[model samples]
Target: MKLKRYLWIAVCLIALAVSMLPAYSEDFFQHHREFRRFLQHHTGFQVSTLGALNVGVYEAAATLAELKSHGDFGLGTFEGLDGEMVVLDGKFYQIKSDGVAYPVKDNSKTPFSAVTFFRQERSLRLTGRMNYQELRSQIDEQLPTSNLPYAIRLKGTFPSLKVRSVPKQTPPYSPLGEVISQQQVVFELQNVQGTLVGFRLPQYLKDVNAAGYHFHFITSDRHKGGHLLDGAFLNPVVDIETLRDWQIMLPSNTAFEEASLE
Candidate 1:
């Protein structure tokens, strides 16, 4: 009887102690639970496929406002492959072939793009300078697995950055390959402080999106950037968000229906 009483008394003390915790304890726990849910439910959304773009399907499938309902950070091309797209902090930007960045209107349309809510899982600070390939390789090594897609954002002052953009095509569209080679404009920027937004996708998604690392850059002032081709990071921090699930919205157009994706 004495032992049982003591055990009951101990239980009561524990319950009291828990109840005496600061009122914020409950709120903290609630926020923690919500954050966990965000991490688990983080999703990547894409509009149209690269294969469709390659086949000359330039019609808009989704508007900027519609995309906001899906994700805030991502990259893609405007309708007609007009320019490079760099999405940051829920703001959409169109970097034209002229190497100029413009704010995208909510009604603007995209033919091929991918986006995510950007719930960061980790951040990395490099100890030495790394170029495009080296930076990707390093990040690759740190990923939990090679099978999942990851959204990465890196901000820093770069030594050199090479980017390009394609001119907006007119009616009677041409294939993407031809447009890129003949109409693309490249820019070389040095000592520029900016944020690089991109993703690392698995090869299995080749038909749906970029198979490897794809990135776009925008200056800190949110102007003058394009599709990132190469760059050197000087020990900057990289933010990473893991996306275990994805949804792709195929265009409901004749071109997409008839494209020779095979």
Candidate 2:
């Protein structure tokens, strides 16, 4: 009889618990919905004007000309304009040409400040008008104190510098090889500016006749492995060596011969 009583009590407890499940679930979903609504409504403007942009920073000179011709002069002036921040209703818009303010149609395109606008443009895309003040507040709360740009200096300079228009240079060795294991790795040359160059890495060394900057590549692989690759044809080479014992290697050509891993 006692066993049966215990079993009956257990069943009753489970039944009671089951009966409360629906109410709990309903409350949970309701709470979730409310939270979503709050985020959507309260921060809608903030979210929409996340990455508005006016022009690319690299094209600042040209953009400044355009702005001077078409954009609002009261917004700012151009020159020494390295970056830009397009804001509307106080939100982040875009990084672009310095000193040039584009006409923002809505609040959905602005980034926080010039620096953020430039960085954000690399990650995001804006389509509409942005609020300047609202975006600014969001930036104030979210960004680091030191990172926030003020009116004192060139605050919005990224958009103007974001322009990337270098002619493509297809490498002869389209696919560079990875450094071999056990090989000491060091940068022999890096053609970042692409001044004297060629398709072949060797040819570039020959043309420039100089060993460029070198960075040591210390890999964990016992067989010393590293990648000699670039996002663009930015040919950069590495020399291989053991961790304790390092060796210096330079280009075979006389011009590059002088290059040293200093």
Clashes of each: 0, 69
CA lDDT, candidate 1, residue 126 = 72
| Winning model by lDDT | 1
Q: Which ten residues in a row have the lowest lDDT in candidate 2?
A: 44-53
Per-residue lDDT over 131-216 for candidate 2, one digit per residue giving the tens place of the 0 to 100 score: 32332233234323322112111111111111111111122211111111222122322212211111111122322211221111
All candidates: TM-score: 0.84, 0.24
Deviation from native of the Cα of residue 199 in model 2, angstroms: 50
Give me the overall lDDT of model 2.
0.23
Off by over 4 Å in 2: 36-82, 87-92, 95-98, 102-262
